[model samples]
Target chain A: MSALKRVQQWATFARVWHIYDASWQNPFKSAELLKKYLMGLHKPIYHPMNDCGDHVIVINSGDIALPGDEWKRRVYFHHTGYPGGATWTLAWELHSKDPTMVLRKAVYNSMDGNLQRRYTMERLHLFPDANVPTNLLKNVSNQIQQLKAKPKRLDHYSENQVKQFPKIFDYPKDYILK
Target chain B: MLLNMNMIVPLGILRNVLFQSKFPIRSMRIFPRLQLKEIREVQNEKELVIYGEIVPSERANILLKNTHPQACPLCASGLDVKHTDILIISQFVRSDGCMLPRRITGLCRTQQKRMSSLVTMAQKAGLMPNLNPANSKKDPKKRFQWKKFNKYFDESTIKS
Candidate 1:
């Protein structure tokens, strides 16, 4: 087959893929973004039954942010199929046990519970860290923008930049502003 | 006389007569008659040894072609083997979070293929970590240090 023909054939059958960075971003917002791609809502040929969803590769899931005290307040419940077997796990506890669970659960909960949901969920690949295999990385053509800007860490700023900021007033030598 | 009697009597009757003549009736009743082959000892022990080795080699050729039967651990434990089982069994994830090979997992070809796909699905679902630890720029062991901010200065300056 000709190169152009092969390329055209691949384009017709292939689904578009996107990479999402979940670091320092709200988990709920990331989940919503992931759901859009997983459902192929961005595509023109989306159908309810057809498995036409684009693949979403999520990286840095371990670093996903939760607003306020949701980490301690959120509770995940499970039962062991025995009497009095119900158990509850705090969000932080679950995140600590499985770094990816927080993001996975958020995305899973956001999706409609239907047969296609499972298939769509399957396409939403999540990595707890930034590392991704080369094969999957190749599929990612673009990165989805984070809803909130990542807060810059103090250590990330150079000494020059820190010193360059305009000073408003000098503090008294003896006064410690605790 | 015996040859003439053998010709006249039937084979079954001849054997009964021979057995009756050899042992007393009471002894015959107590012990069943033994076949000649059963009572006889082997004349050559070396011949038996040679036959034993030769027979096994012919049987081994047929048996060697079959794979050793090994049940999948999940299946043996009555657990429905899923992608999660693959991660648990392998223990260590690849730098890219790819699955360990079948040789390492001891899974059959079909199970290995199924597991590979499941791992991919798990990765997409945010259920598995995919980052290569070695390639990450951030120090994994860095501790979060607490810094006391001056209340006199605007809080926004320090927060950013």
Candidate 2:
């Protein structure tokens, strides 16, 4: 394909991904896993030199889940190196202190921590609440699609099978009905 | 002469208790399974007195912390739960500390694993302190009575 034709083709096929910040309900979802999926890192077309990454719009980060009593039990430690330099905060405490920050840190930590990481992460929009941001990307033509909810089954296999075997366990002639 | 009697009398009594005492002494100690619940509950306060021993507490804490779901070291979710909240963390064995499984907590296996890793990490991080009194604290040597040595060994005379 010609360069111009390929560019147009690429633009047409370019996708945006919308990731629900189900962290509050599903905190076990690793930021690392999410980053890989959102960054197009798993794709065959991934180019280290080019910004071939997709835009990822994350919503409801404030509600992100952490696996255990980690919200309370785990302590994050930091140090200033002075005599009283070290300080720590419990996971739940940090969430309460700044829920957005707790998520931001997770997302940031998931990145490569290089110069390109800053630019790549810039393409990611993390919202503390479920509401989408209007300024950065807005509800544009390139907006990501909402997730398809899983289908539920109303009638079960057992009920359907009942027609074929009306009385699956037939009582013997000598057996009492009671 | 009186002072000599005071020393000699107790020494004689001690010797009798040690050497003259019959082998096995026909003594019966009712260990009765030595269960804590069977023992009368002491009115004393239940405190986790951590004095000097650091290794076992560190190990237990790491094990407990890693096993806890809410405080898992492997995932981000546990960055918010409590160390003792078994709802977010658990162990194979039921104890005063570990949380029960998710059928009780209503959490899935994913969350459970995350919580457990966090708890284990915390234990490794020394966040969970050793809980046993013997391991947690030791009496100041000066305050420990020499009489307590009787608990560990039988008194015997040395023939020079």
Candidate 3:
């Protein structure tokens, strides 16, 4: 066999596994990363027909981020095919109903609709929390870097720091602000 | 009841008598019946009588099989991971800045993949913060400022 053919054979057979942390990152950003891995776009052996993609295990899907007022303005719609069957759900409502829905939708939309896409999607696994099965964790070869760093919460601040912070304005003594 | 003789008189005899009295010179002429009889005989031999009424057959009504409704979160949302869809990003990430799993989020495999990637893109674009404000070491007052970049001019083209 030719050397090139032998290398191609290896590329077709070998598969890698990846673990991605979605905590505090925007869902759209996460999807761009997943699209690359799922479609095998990052690999030299990547081809449209070849299933050279690696397995992607996503953890902390519940902690994805949103930039602006999408929680109030964005809406999701559903229809039951009957009279008055249309249902319009706000993004917040959908997320509350199912925390993984937003992430799932984001990823699904990024992929092209085809048999290969479906097969690649089968390799994706999602977890809301960090409790992953040992068998799957054993297969994880690497961890995909998160696009953004998580912001600290107010409760995480030290008591001394909070007290040391300067006041923006002072209220007059005995003044009724209300 | 009295019977009228005129009404009871036979029409054939009355016609013969009237014809004989009116003009004995004219011989009685008979219409031809051989053509009529031949046609009737041929029709009787060829015609077939159908006795029963024809009823059309009906097609069977087969009941359709029921399918399970797709309850996957990704399939239900019908939204893609775009920079503008901030609502999805916020919901997917938790208060502690961790992603929710399929068990809680109820997304299919494909959707989970897409969601994570979109989140990463949003973070890289600086549309979303990497860390939660409350948990970060940076001062909250300086945290939300947008980044600005200055345009550079070519040194070769511009005179100092």
State the lDDT of candidate 3 residue by residue for B30-143, as single tens digits.
223211111111123434222222222111122112233364545554444454344445456554455656654556787666666655544433444433446653332233
Lowest lDDT block of 10, candidate 3 chain B? B146-155
Q: What is the DockQ of each candidate?
A: 0.00, 0.01, 0.00
User: Ten-residue segment with the worst summed lDDT in candidate 2 chain B?
Assistant: B147-156
Q: lDDT rank, highest first?
A: 3, 1, 2
> Tens digits of per-residue lDDT for model 2 on A43-65?
67776775566666677666554
Error of 2 at A118 (Å): 2.6
In model 1, which regions exceed 4 Å deviation? A1-13, A172-178, B1-160
> lDDT of all predictions, in order shown?
0.56, 0.44, 0.58
Model 1 score (lDDT) = 0.56
TM-score of chain A of each: 0.88, 0.62, 0.80
Candidate with better lDDT, 1 vs 3? 3
* Candidate 1: residue A19 Cα off by (Å): 0.6
Tens-place lDDT digits, model 2, residues B1-160: 1122112233444346656655755543222332221212122243222121112111222222334545423342333444433222323212322534554333457656555554554332223333113343222111222211101100121111
**Positional deviation of A95 in candidate 1, in angstroms?**
0.5
**How far is A26's C-alpha from truth in model 2 (Å)?**
3.7
